[model samples]
Target: MLINVPENVVPDALRGFAAVHTDLTVDVERRVIVRRGAPYDGQVGLVSGGGSGHEPLHGGFVGRGMLTAACPGEVFTSPVPDQMVRAAAAVDSGAGVLFIVKNYTGDVLNFDMAAELAEDEGVQVAKVLVNDDVAVTDSLYTAGRRGTGATLFVEKLAGAAADEGAPLDRVAGIARRVNEASRSFGVALSACSTPAKGGPTFDLPEGELELGVGIHGEPGRERRAMMTSGEIADVSVDAVVDDLQPDAPVLLLVNGMGATPLLELYGFAAEVHRAMGARKVSVARTLVGNYVTSLDMAGASVTICQADEELLRLWDAPVSTPALRWGC
Candidate 1:
């Protein structure tokens, strides 16, 4: 069974979501919002997003130590310039705004236009495109890579630094560090429905799984026989840790794609913890749940953050927002 709606439905939902955060958001084009008053002088405003199905992502990450605004797109479509321009204006303080965009064609183009618009308005605009999906080969079709789970880690960590009053350059540097050290790979047990498509975006015949699937319905590296939760966790975490070789203590996240339940996520987290200890790697802390996701993709992704002293401190800092709030 498939369930897709009109393409514009997601935009409508975004508009309504923004209305609730009137003090923190604005649905100017009906799909975006700025989080607060103009960023403090010498403070950098952060912006991020991609498609809509991955809710509680870009938007949920808005607030202290997260994002200043989030521009959402239709189901899986990238948001256009109109949305980005409005968000940029609302958040631009004296310093500048950092666009934390995932590596996707429409997202890059639209955000680029917004940057031009902001620069014309005499605001400094810097952009960091995240492409941490190691599953995607560095090749044609895309502008080199794809951004996956790293988007969340970068947003929260970078926002943490910015909240500490770091300059745009320094905050951007921290974001880059997070990106360079993190990698993600996902698998889909079942396909998700798209509003525009009105049905399951992809199909998995019953027990087969697609490994390394992209968040936006792209085909993954390979499909394989199914395995238990612990084995799945072992394989995915191995891919991430092997790529990073993060000698320092690291932050571990075992995340549900969207439809996956917390019970499964907890089981996945336990396996991740066991595997890391076996590798002699230090776990600074662990965050488990659906922090970043693909519509209803029934899968999980693992992200490892090799944190330096400063970064760990930032991660520990308090953050208040619709999705994540702690250390209050």
Candidate 2:
């Protein structure tokens, strides 16, 4: 919000992001971010995109063990079908392409249309819809559950499977299973300000919290007096566990909503660990950071994925992206 750029803020930001990550090549014209070496023969290409505000998401995630290409649209706006079509064409090998779409009305609609466009060019396209947020269903913008933190799990698990040369159907199935086993809940201390909007998306009085807040600043399940960090973690864990009934081993993601500092994120992670311990849930793997975030929103979200051996193995697989890198 404090930065200044030309009129085309999204494109300008993309140029800077591309400069820092040489492995990620940005098509300034198409607004698509592609991995340097992609479209591996017999491997399913993974393409995902959405609004631009949530960085280190669709774009920063473009690399090996993750997305093949990511097409970013204007802030909070769905990418046009052209971007997806071109990305699919560029990344699709004989094994086909997979579209990891979050469950939002505009995203679903546009991605579905893009699939049809790609099919016209003889590219086999499959899709996995992520609606893992256990917040208010059928929110103001989405038809059903709004996709949130759990999207990262789907991308990693499915991307690992795809990188292993799994066919489109197999990759889609893996992503679907991940989605089915995950749940998320969020709490917001304040709202985010988009460059275009020039103001916070929503308002919150001092010492108040919005529970189950969506990534796009949509109204949450409820608003109440602010609770301590520990209390917030307990409530968030309870909501996700109640929905998930997680297996013995669970993958936990304590995500900061953009503006939330890492110190606070780690603090919340500790609280979540204690809360899950009290509930008899085993924390198999933990990721604490801002993987999925709302723009400059002072908040955090918790995502839990019930992990089996297969899921854990896939999760531990090598991934090299700008925002997330490990085991590479």
Candidate 3:
């Protein structure tokens, strides 16, 4: 809404982002954001990307102990294969590169093509798909479950492995393991407006909410009247916990969908914790905030990853990224 022109939104934002994030090399022409000291010798490269509007996701996660490079697409649209090829090439060290792709049709297809292109260029590449959203078996944008909050978990844990000089196979293994262990569910309190549309993408009447909503404002499982934070948490947590059926302590991500205030998110988090307790699920680590977001969508999603000792350790490893950083 504050943008000068809808057409230049992505490029204009990239310019400002480049100016602010001096540690990253934001190639505006290529639309690839890579760490300054990329191709870290023997370390396997980590690359992930998706549509824009979800700030601090692929782009903001590009830094030490996280993504080596990220390719950003236009709002709610997948990046082309060229961007992925360039990102893989830019970050590929002697070790192979790992592509952490979300399970969207456009993303999967584009990343698949990019892997082939990168490999043809002598950059060995592997890929792991993130499909942790448990709301539906399939969605408008995906053949399978849509990738959601677990993307941050996969990027963080897998990035740590890569930072520790893990081989391409091992890094990919960690990513796959994380994905297999995670589940997410979202609720939408309001619809988001896109720059291109300049209006609400979907119609949501006042005092109603969409349960099990997708991040891109897609139709969800059901619509219901407005519920209290505790009631919403009960439903969201039940969805994830029932699907996950965790045997071990879990890593919890109570993520905001862009427009929700921290005040509401924290309160909702309290209810989520309570719900988990009621379900007899132990939470090992809790992260609450707007990590993965839908543009100005006032809602939240709950992501639960059953954490093993290794996963917890990798999570605790030092990370220095714009969006998520600790122990650095």
Candidate 4:
């Protein structure tokens, strides 16, 4: 809670973000972040957003090879239709814009409304919903599986396709394919506090953790006593593997839920790899870090994306974003 005022948290952070990332244009008033050289003519525009706490996500991923524009809402709150409409309008390059929406109820409704509004404004728009979390079928914030770590996979692959001047439909198709090919599961070590709350958002007694937790602190499968990193990986990896049943080599994401450090993340990643090997799952690529987060929650999530040759090629494409950058 190192903020001036609870209400000004997002805007305040945007100012700092704009100052640091010169390649991005942060419209604090409108609460939208767009790449400096947007509207790439024949390239399909990629737009995605969500609540504010998940840094380096919809915002930090905005760049030449990822999101073209992002509309950030208040922490843990969905952005309004106006924000989405503005983002779509800003990035549409006549090749049309694609909205990459998470599967939350509020996000689904608002982005849907924005797509229609953008179409009315003569901007062709397509959308893909990401519902990769395999933890639960329903959660407090969603009627179906919640979107989690695999969002990074969808955004990167789709953005690469868009950057290649893929048509709107093709880019949308890639995004949908990535979502369908991915699955994620999360476990929380502790609860996170918001600027407004000024304290832990949820209570977890000592020596306990939440399994299959949601990004916004939503309840998961069940609570259990603290376990070793390897044990946690065994269960998490099992959850996704059972559901995915991948037939090809996969891309793995060992994502931190904000407060977890890299030291622990890398170690946990080792265990994840071990678990994957035990299941006879082949891993083609691995990414580890706080790409997708949940405020200051101390936990991590595992995402697995079954990758065909084409999917792997798109993933290997150059991406220059604030959080994830490589092959540049």
**Top model number, lDDT:** 3
Please tell me which model should have the higher lDDT, number 3 or number 4: 3
**How many backbone overlaps does candidate 4 show?**
0
Name the TM-score of candidate 3. Answer: 0.98
Candidate 1 backbone collisions, by pair: 4-198, 5-195
lDDT of 4 by residue, 138-231 (tens): 4565598888888899999999998888999999999999999999999999998988888888898879999999899665678999999999
Model 1, residue 134: C-alpha shift (Å): 1.1
State TM-scores per candidate: 0.94, 0.97, 0.98, 0.98
Report the C-alpha displacement of residue 198, candidate 4, in angstroms. 1.4
Model-by-model lDDT, in order? 0.81, 0.89, 0.93, 0.92
**Candidate 1 off by > 4 Å:** 1-5, 19-23, 140-142
- TM-score: which is higher, 1 or 4? 4
- Cα lDDT tens digits, model 2, 1-328, are 5567525888788888778889877898888898887778899999999987787788988889989999998888889999999999999877899999998889999999999999999999989999888886555665889888888999999999988888899999999999999999999999888887788878888899999998886658899998999999999999999988976699999999898999999999999999999999999999998888888888999999998999999999999999889999
Worst 10 residues of 2 by lDDT: 1-10
Q: What is the lDDT of residue 54 in candidate 4?
A: 91
Models ranked on lDDT: 3, 4, 2, 1
lDDT over C-alpha atoms for residue 14 of model 1:
64
Query: Higher-TM-score candidate among 1 and 2?
Result: 2
- What digit string (tens of lDDT, one per residue) describes model 3 on residues 16-109? 9899999999999879999998989999999999999898898999998999999999999989999999999889887999999999899999
Model 2 C-alpha RMSD to native: 1.6
The residue ranges of model 2 lying beyond 4 angstroms of the native Cα positions read 137-142
